[model samples]
Target: MNNLELTDNVSAAAKRDIFELQKKIGAFSNDEGAEEAFRKYRLTRGVYGQRQPGVQMIRIKLPYGYVTADQLVRIADCSDKYATGNLHATTRQDIQLHFVKLADSPQLWADLEDADITLREACGNTVRNVTASATAGIDPDEPFDVSPFAQAIFEYFLRNPISQEMGRKFKISLSSSEKDSALGFMHDVGLIAKMGKNENGQPVKGFKVVIGGGLGAQPFPAQTAYEFLPEDQAIPFIEAVIRVFDRYGERTRRHKARMKFLLNDLGLEKMMELVQEERTALKNKVYPVQDIAYSWKNLGERVPLAKEEILALADAQLEDSEKELFQKWLATNVFEQKQKGWYGVSLRVLLGDMHSSTARKLADVMRQYAADDLRVTINQGYLLKFVKAEDLPALFKALSQLGLADPGFDSTADITTCPGTDTCNLAISSSYGITRALEVMMKEEYPDLIYNNDIKIKISGCMNGCGQHSAANIGFHGSSIKNKKLVLPALQVILGGGFTGANSEGQMGDKVIKLPSKRGPEAMRTLLDDYQNNAYEDEYFNQYYARQTKNYFYQLLKPIADLSEVKDDEYRDWDHDELFKTEVGVGECAGVMIDLVGTTLIEADEKLSLAHEMLAEGVWADGIYHAYNTFITGAKALLIGEGISTNSQHSMVKEFEENFGKTFYPEAGDDSKPFSQLVFSINKNEPTEAFARGFVGKAEDFLKNVKAFRAGQLAENSIPALQELVYGQDS
Candidate 1:
């Protein structure tokens, strides 16, 4: 069946979501108050605000990096119609389209959903796309496929009430094998597939669970939460962990709102204890992941050349230069799959951006000479699977025509970068521009390094690490320097970071020095030249960097960092004609922040309603968590009204007790428990029907009292009215 013709069968839920988005978009024109709220809502549906004012960026969620040929064509068509004719494959295994008008997003989403693709929860504070190894089903080193597990998690969290409005965005990754090709260790939650035996000595599938890992201004390596967790318990365990984070994670301090920071504040032992405490409220103790049977058709059976013809072609190889090029392309870009007589070809996508025309051509190529399925790699590339070995030459020629058959696949010549100043609001310099300069320098001056995969180069617009600069062997993040009266774009050089070996133990880069953005290529050259000349035989870049230390590189690149010798051209940033200025906009990467007292109270009421709904549904754990959030939200609203800012939900609980507990309801039922103690009973009691009902009742009373208090303050003019305060402001 043609995948494109598969049916525009939109699920009722999806239809409702699309309709709601349309309504919100329509409402935004008349009601300015709805703009921020709508922006937040659209983000959860994958409509992100771009650096450009009038347009948006759409991110399409593709679980585990899996894409079918038909889906690719559909995306290409959408890009051509609704956005710039380009598709950017993100490191998280999602595809992004830029320069899309906000009004056209609904139609674009509908177009994608026609092919059963979704943009839901692709961004925002919700659980982002769940990723896994690109080679999951076919990797020779994999113990078993992780595709099903990743898909299960992706589905479970799509609109799960627990994660819809978290303190920060959550990420999850599953590796097919211990090799951790998915870069699992750097995600919010990482799962490594493992095989173990039960008490009866029968083999059982499981995962090595890691938590709180992330890449950002402050990168944290994930700590092992469980050496082995049974497959059946994975979902429930993950849900409990999220519940804990939701109730206790930071809220006001955006910078400290990630799971890693939460884990840092609460020791691993205490965090585990909290997770265990929430298990009683869980909707399921064990969720059995159904086996996924994945099969690919169209594995190119037709050989364009006969055996004798292929032999003749091989023997007639002509120029030594042509022969060497072919050999290099084969060695770097082609790898034998576990399946006999089949190979996987890696297509290096320059900076992860491919024009729609190129994408359609690649899809057509897949329909003819490879499997219908393709996997987008974590390093911003594509892996074409199930190609017949006999078709290698023809395939290379086809890809070469598309400018995708670059000899280096994930080698030093293959640089990874984020959109940076091109489209990211938080960027300090031009990451894409400097990246191009560096790549050209490497290919032109240090061509031999194309074969070296040990050294990776990654650049981020800023220290937020969107480009995963902290995970590179040699990294640069956008920064700036101050001269007497001017500012210049700069790159913060970092060293000694990357995957140490096949086991996937990752090391974060250390900041070495900052240099002018225009001189980034020279800085890279300096580091590579030093490593090449001084390193011992067989020493990898990371090992050599560790031996030389950060000071060594800082001293070597210090000349470039000297702002005293700044030239006139240094005043302009890469790819920019005007003088450099640090113009950063508020980042919506974590979702819009609503600070209106009334808006917050309304959110509290909504949480209360959701708690009631969950209680009716008999989802005890979910109800209890919702009630907990209701109390926190109500208290936060009142506190914010008093001009008291809260750094975290936990701190809000304490602050509310200190400020209002004694003045308001001083005691509760039996034993005269304080209001704070009563509200906190959520974590103390098991998630039973009785406890859920009682906690929800208390939350109801707490919200009522909070509303009454606010009314009295309003009547007395002691607090600013909603209209008096700046409302609907985007943060």
Candidate 2:
């Protein structure tokens, strides 16, 4: 899409409004006029898709999942600025604006660019934004600070050549504590901090490395690659891990590109054998840099405070009635500092939001109470570190004014969700909105039920499973199809998808339950109420789900499902398919989140900056990344409106040649036909849409744009670095 020097489409859409705004641009061909289209592609944050006829979707990138309060304001503004005032947050932490006209992406990008947010790395194969503990530095229990390293990696990896054309997407995670909230155990490479007595018996910090963990068509847990690599060696250690993955990973299978599968197939002994040799050689090539690879940075000067500060600040922050509950939440949710009088508190938000005036307030509050530092966690939570006891009360009040001092600090509402159905073309359900609605529903209907520790409700828009429904105790995956004679909306309800420190891939529920039309929010409320009230003693949400299959849930939910009076039948959610089956895919949560070795997140950054992560240093080939990419490419072909059973004979190569540019000279096969074409082929305006009845018609146009929406996963992973230079936009 980037080949165009300028966009001057000879065949463009007519702005003339008709009784109905409808027209066919014909097949999106890269034909003679392709260059101009490519030209416009560069200036715009997104391209057009035909998930349905006469509709388009726009994607916005959020680097490393970092969006400032101002940027969110920009999102709210741009939503008003163009299309509709609605934004969708993605599993990748990117935001998407749907219903966008094909002609408006440029202005949208220009507006977003004004806020230093770029749609560039939002998709394509580019190095994605670096993620870390939202509670970094502020968590007193953290052994090392990870923000610097995550930032450095984000800076270094963006547009780097070696990273750009990765055999498959490379994911790296960094965490500083052992709480394992970041799920470091399930990433391409996970770094966890291991704090203990060193040989000298004094406090020391370093990492416990885990490699090759991912979830997808095939799920695998990350493994320990190394232990006790001092804080200093973090950069070289990660570089070594990358080299191991890039060199020895699989390349032939679309289902096997992830590093986790590699670790499983090769076994750690053999994997390390390859890595050790590579590391030895790399060290020799970089003399001075190699020498500092094992130094521990956390042993530096400690930040101290008075003991009275922690007590006073926390005591002062609470309202009379909320003080007790707030204190308990704080005790469990906040971290105790090593210093006598300081503490770090977690500022949790619903689905990664600290909006508008609150953003400004939080920053100010942190500055006043904290030591000018904060950490962002992959879980979309924030941290305020080094607060004196005296300031805690006021800080809490300030945060409460911002509507952020919700009691769910570590409670269920401190949830993580991807923007689904609302904006993403790939999305099938409204994950976050629904999550919020559900949270509220539970609060109103069965507040005490959710207070129990074991139940967590997670939702994903579609099969890509961004919301991680497959891992939640009560998970929801969005899907659509028609019933005997009607169109409908539905969610493949999963009962038991759980992830804890002990195991992986929680039990999945069965049956596709219909969503309530006007009372969709009420439908979830019913399910939650039923579960909360009927749950077995000591049974967590997933455990209860395991006891009852999706079939049972559906049977229980049939009453609510039958209540739909949706006018546009197509928008009605129903027609349950084999959606209840639990199938996990190979997807890493993002590396910057899982890999923490020592409390310092930036140690890797300093090390990477100093040693420089080289392309040749790591030979990249992973079966999973390749498989996922190829799967997406193949999936795209099937989506092109055809007799698309699991098994199909026809292909879309003919259309690919006419539509996609030479860069994507699709071959005559299922794998070669770009998926974008298949999605665009969907007929949108069909009031009696056949795909999923009215629901597909209501949302089909959104689906067609899924392929075109990949801002960083497909094409942006590579960039030619000038020996020691790095690239990326920081929030």
Candidate 3:
């Protein structure tokens, strides 16, 4: 394995993760069930398979979208080194670099971790990046900053044992305030900052909590779990929730596996009861997060302008056009900070993509005119905080020079879109192409909409909702319609979906109609024109949509959806010269579980080794959890060898007892109980050193028995060995 030549300052854990990835990549070809096994492993480390073969997309996790200028420069450097020179900001507040070779993933990860940024758990069925409002700390309406709390949640779950191998991906959000800028209602756990008075009349910091929200083909609004949950118990409460999810979440039916499904199946009351049952095993009852806002000072090599130069630039005159553009930008993108005279500036990144050169320039701009704190917005833009009011002109000039100072920051023109057909396997059409066309049309025709914040336009390549289309006032997802035998790319028009500035009652767009990909621009124009002509004065887009009704909009757009007079270009999807074809591959937005008997046992052995290593490092909780995984993996291996379907951890436990509890592995020993009891003990006992040691010992004995039974089966030729199953016998 090739090791990184990183400085001693790099984290030991990061180095180990990289080394493990390299080792796995090296051994992949020889392992049985390698394709499925390796795919699951790499995804947890943030290396994802792209739509294009022989390349991967590396997702760099930026918790709460916070990035320093120096860190931005580092990311740019890595983008130039390991990927195409483009950096794509995702709606989840992550930076994704595409076209990375699988072998280079380890070094790319190492280079990123060298700058205190991580790729860990960035993509996978693990705890994804914890998001917050881009205006988190500085929002004028916020009760308190949610940055530190978001960071704490991110840190607590990154590589934590409870969330590593869940049945589906988990998402969490911490909105700055009741405005819910982070869209708290769309996450597994949504927390909005709230200040309350205690019994003694002292001010207490807490959150109004919501749980089990999600957006996909089927969207669900989160239920209000608590009106107020004290800040101190945040980590423990989340920990308990994840534990319950890990145990009970679905595995066989991929579509029915999100936490929302689990919540729906077992109601909120029953879910809370399970969470209460697991609280005794939590590591921290009260985790007090540190305030991170104090560390916003610039720390980069870029030089800043002198005080006199800044003053002069602030006072500098602008041309007529430049002045008009600047005024529009100020109206749309600039907002006052809660910290008196300072301002927050949002830079609208076209399609959420910028070249490496642009990123480096952005870093310099951050150092020159703004605080070191750079936030990636959920709308796929950049937010620079703590800019002095006087410095706005200089900042605007600098950003404009980079082609990033578009007037619309998060408006109708500022369309949120995912990398649909360009990189995602699930995307059915070209989101980038359609988004570009819409933006150009909007800029040329409806230039005044840049100042309109009441309407949101969002696009997703598919129904997966990575671009968060379901929550926008106007949304479109990629689809296809057949004309005779030819398939034409289409966009499903959705309307009336939006947040009402209240987390408890968020709306999801209703599907109105589908139009050919080429007609997407026309559809937007038609909607805008209709609203402008018939709506009540000062009415928002959603209100107009509500008034018009779904059938009304369908009738209105049914003309655009008509294929009777389709042009030749209509046969082709956006940005593609070739005719359209529906050729979507398997979606890896959330990696699926595919374990064979042979490789599953090997994985079990590996987990046992990890358990011992954790024990040696005195990480009792981690060790106990690893041992717990060992039990599940070993039991799963035997059941899979028997061709029994393994759907979920909880189900597998029950199935193992029903199938072979006292049959092949008879309960002869005095200490032997049901296999389910041994595994369930993890959540029943505290994670002390003694319990961890004993649990690991029990796991070792369990694995030995499993291996012995497997050997007997092999001797009888009842099951194929790893090599024979993967390759062939009689070499």
Candidate 4:
């Protein structure tokens, strides 16, 4: 679409946001400090810097992976115009467009907004896209549709103040049934639909809540927070937990800032106590989720063929080899839904990358034969819903033409991988390269294993686990081994991790050994060979690993771990001819740390300005939270000037009082209320206009005091690193 057409399609608010982003980008081109600040801001808006300089990757949020045909076409157009003519479907069910010039991001965003799609809060420290089971509405075993609840949470958190500037990114997922198809066990907050009896013994709707789970450098399994929390209380409960996390979660140590760490520190019981303490401060005590009216657009009134007739027609049309392959595809890729006469067809996009032209074709196919509802699966595949059973053959043929009709959907052959050395700044090795090699090996050598759905293989370029390696039955993440003077890229092999599915628990992978990156395919072959020979009938991969134990696998793969026998080629990383040299860049996944005192003070002024803007707009709660951050930024700046670095805002407030309270207010001594008490008043009182104005006034005074204090320190030349302060220091 042209600029005018795009502008006409979006709301005035979205247009303003895109224009402001363009203005900020232009400003940053002239000022390096402004670039650092804008980098953080843009990430929250879903524009992320790729590993390559001067280009960006824009992540588009798709709640529950639901996309209309028109939206897909728009995405394809945007990819063709602004990106590399490709869309990468992420494990989180979001689509990423890579290799776009930074200057074009605003235009790209405007184009997406034209289709009612968004890039806002798709990355950075905000609550990410709320994911749900791809089979939410059609699952036979589901108690109720989880789409409404997931959508509700997505709407509630979009532009919500509580999570906009969190210590780290937050993830929430809703599962349709006990099957946990959404992989709820590995998210920050996981909700599984449940049916329970109220006090009066009537059936009530609720969720089985799990909290604090995460897969990163260190993986943590989520713990149960509630056996059955009434559906209406879900939002309030989540908001309360977020408030507690915002107030107390670590900020300085990026690696230690996840909600999982807070849960680990406080324990589940104590964490729940803190959550309860914040209940009174929540914006809503009970947010009843209204049932969403979801309708599938019927392509045409074509009569569905009977099962016998469909089989007969397929037999007549297919050649012997084609029929055999079609049977395998149907057995592995097509799902019979709860809806009679309908099916869910899964297309495995190799490594989650689909060319723009192919995507446009897929959209056309959906509009012609399916329900026009396309859901991206968590395993980097596409699930086309509500296809007539008879239409499967035609759909398969069309998908085959587009190279998407692969057999294995979520089986071992359907490997999950992250954009490692391909685009991510923190990736130390080439995950995509190794993943391609492994997939080829599996299809060519272990073709019969395509139907094995019990085992999963996942890979990440690093231990950050963006590929969710920790939750796989067999997993690998990038690493390195130093042998004498040579450093070779390596893959850390992990085993025995996977979900048991429906009424069962899951386990995180145990690290077994590290092997050269080139030998990853060989290592996979060995693991599969051993499993085939030793496993009992129908024995799952994790169960077999548990019986054999970690030591056994370590011994089995130990030969490959011997660096003394490494060849010259072992020094090379996958997809690169040059010898491996780890060039890990600073990850902007959680936003960069700002350490310059002056820059921090400038940020405080910005926060104050936002506070005033929010208050003027009558968003009292958001204005109060912004004012609260203003206080934190000013205090942190003063503390940094004193070389007294604190990890969290809570600590910053306490340290400020301890060091400067007596000097600033001599009479109020130890008997006075702590500075935390004053700054944290945002949650103590109702978020009314009077309170918002009062809080903003207090923040203004605090910023003035901090600026004056810093000026005096500069006059005395007491602060160190006057001109050498780095803007992105971690601590």
Best by lDDT: 3
Model 2, range 594-704, lDDT digits (tens) per residue?
111111112223222222222122322121122223323333332332332221112233433344424343354645544444332221211121322322222223222
RMSD after CA superposition, every candidate = 4.5, 16.4, 3.9, 3.7
Candidate 4: tens digits of C-alpha lDDT, residues 647-716: 7778888899898887655677596855677897777887778988998998898787777677677758
Residues 1-731 of candidate 1 have per-residue lDDT tens digits of: 11122235877678778877777787786674545677778889999988889899899999998999899999999999999999999889999999998878888888889889999999888899998988887788878888899999999888787898889999999998887777767888899999988889899999999999888888888889999998999999999888888878887788999999999889899999999988766778799999775666333234333445533453464344455666678878877676656778899988899999999999999988888779888888999988876677777778878998889898989999999989888898998889888988989999887788888889999999989999888899999989899999989988888875556487788988888899898888888889889999987788888887889888999987887688989889888999999988878888656666777777788799889998998988778878888998899888988888776666788788777876676554333438667776766667789998989898999888887787667768865555243222320
Candidate 2's TM-score: 0.58
- Candidate 1, residue 634: lDDT: 92
**Model 1, CA-based lDDT:** 0.84
Task: Report lDDT (Cα) of residue 7, candidate 4.
Answer: 62
Candidate 3 Cα RMSD after full superposition onto the native fold (Å): 3.9
User: What would the per-residue lDDT of candidate 3 be over residues 1-731, giving only the tens digit for each residue?
Assistant: 56556656579888888888888888874563468888899999999989999999999999999999999999999999999999999889999999999888888888888899999999889999999999987888888888999999999998898798889999999988887788888899999899987789899899999999999999888899899988988888999999999889998899999999999999999999999988777787678778874565333222334445434554575555677687778778888677766778998998999899999999999888888889999999999987876677878888889999888889888999999999999999999999999999999999889978888899999999988889998999999999988999999888888763344357788989999989998899999999999989877777778877899999999989998888888999889999999989998867666656777887888899989999999999889988989999899888988889866899999888877887645744544656778789888888899999999999999987887777677768855554455324432
Cα misplacement distance, residue 362 of candidate 3 (Å): 1.5
Each model's lDDT: 0.84, 0.49, 0.86, 0.86
Please give the lDDT score for candidate 2: 0.49
Q: Could you tell me every candidate's TM-score relative to the true structure?
A: 0.91, 0.58, 0.94, 0.94
